[model samples]
Target: MKGEHILPLSQSGSARNTHIEDHLDGSSAAIKVIVFGGLDGILTMFAVVSGCAGAAISPLQTICVTLGTLLASAFSMAYGEFISCKAERDYVESERLREEREVEEKPEMEKKEMLDIYTNRYKFSSADAHDLVELTFRNKDFFLRHMMAEELGILLTEDDMTPVKKGLVMFGSFCILGSFPLIGFIGNFLGESGSDTSRIIGFTTTALFSVIGAMSLGYFKGSYMRQRRMISALMMALNGVVVGFISYLSGLVLMTLFPEASI
Candidate 1:
């Protein structure tokens, strides 16, 4: 059955690394979701910490806000990814079942539809379409498999952990990445006596992380090293600017609210 073939492809991999590679290459949508989610979390937390520092808030306050934001963002992102992936899986499954029914009840019509799909996709002539259809339909099951794999590109069965696993990975990765800047803040603040030194350390750490992430993503996508470096630097700089602006605004509000505070 088509389901048998499809199921193998879906589950073909070592359990340990399948999810990791899948998130990297399964669908562009999944990759983008994870990348952007991490980027946003990092930027958001960086800005919050910077703002607190700007407002002259104590190290303790900064740590509290950064940790709070990290936790909240991670949970929200994870849950959102879970729901979205589940919906996609459900839609794919529903379509597979519909295709299965069509194959059972209207074999000839389904064959014609499959031919048309391939014909339009590959731009084949009428004679070629008929020839191709005949060749594909030699085994009834083969024809259905071709239609499912080529025309629909949806599988009959999938890993139970697909969406939930992906969500957890994305959220956890983001939280970990985001915490870098905050950790920098804590280290600088606790280790150094001067606020200025701490702020510099925090900003440098944030920028470094952004550059590294961008370069990694670009390299994985097979872009030129020089171009990727430039792109990464630009993205990091842009992130810094946006976060800096937010932090400035937040600092203003914080300072107004806490007149007794050093800020």
Candidate 2:
């Protein structure tokens, strides 16, 4: 029994599902990767950049801090996202194995459950329910897949997106999207001879990039669900505002605590 239960699920890992982009919800993972990654990168770098500037730290030190943030945050977000998505996938796979066991042990009960679902939730007539259920029953693979989807809302993975891939997606997008805010600072650092104007450019440029990314995400998510677009944009922008406030406040505190230290 245990061996049978484990076999199907174990094999599913190797099974190819379908295209990820076939469904509207397909881009959810990527959106999260981009939005959150961009927002976090912008806000954090903005704060550090501000704090370093406030402390009157040299441009070299500021770059060091900003660059360090880019690397550290990207790695952290990638690892964390990988773990999160993988955990959910693992849970669903485990449940699938359990369901397979139940279906094998009690085929009649499983069939009846499907019949009930179709008739009650889907409003399928009795005749249709019987035919549908019977069709699923004759094929163990289809039966398991149907049961998992209809009853559990757990569809087979639509794509071969592994945790590693998801992580890389996040890491790559995050580094790129998040780098927007740092662009001005970097540009000034490279173009100007270390001056107050360069510092001004750094913060201002960071703000502009952060705003663009945050607002774009807001609009995308809002419109994605056919929701009130304005509300969605405002809400997403609010997240950036909160993060920025906190970052700025932290920088302020840092500057306050060490008036003499050039950190």
Tell me the TM-score of each prediction against the true structure.
Answer: 0.68, 0.71
Candidates' C-alpha lDDT: 0.66, 0.73
lDDT string for model 1 (45-93, tens) is 7677667766866677778878988998888888888887777776766
Per-residue CA lDDT of model 2 for 31-149, tens digit only, reads 65666776676666666776666566777787888898889999999999899877777777788888889998998999899999999999999999999999878989889977887
lDDT of 1: 0.66
Stretches of candidate 2 off by over 4 Å are: 1-28, 109-142, 149-153, 192-198, 222-234
- Return the TM-score for candidate 1, rounded to 2 decimals: 0.68
Model 1 stretches with alpha carbons more than 4 Å out: 1-37, 54-56, 118-123, 139-142, 145-161, 192-237, 249-263
**Pairs of residues at least 3 apart in sequence or in different chains that clash in candidate 1:** none
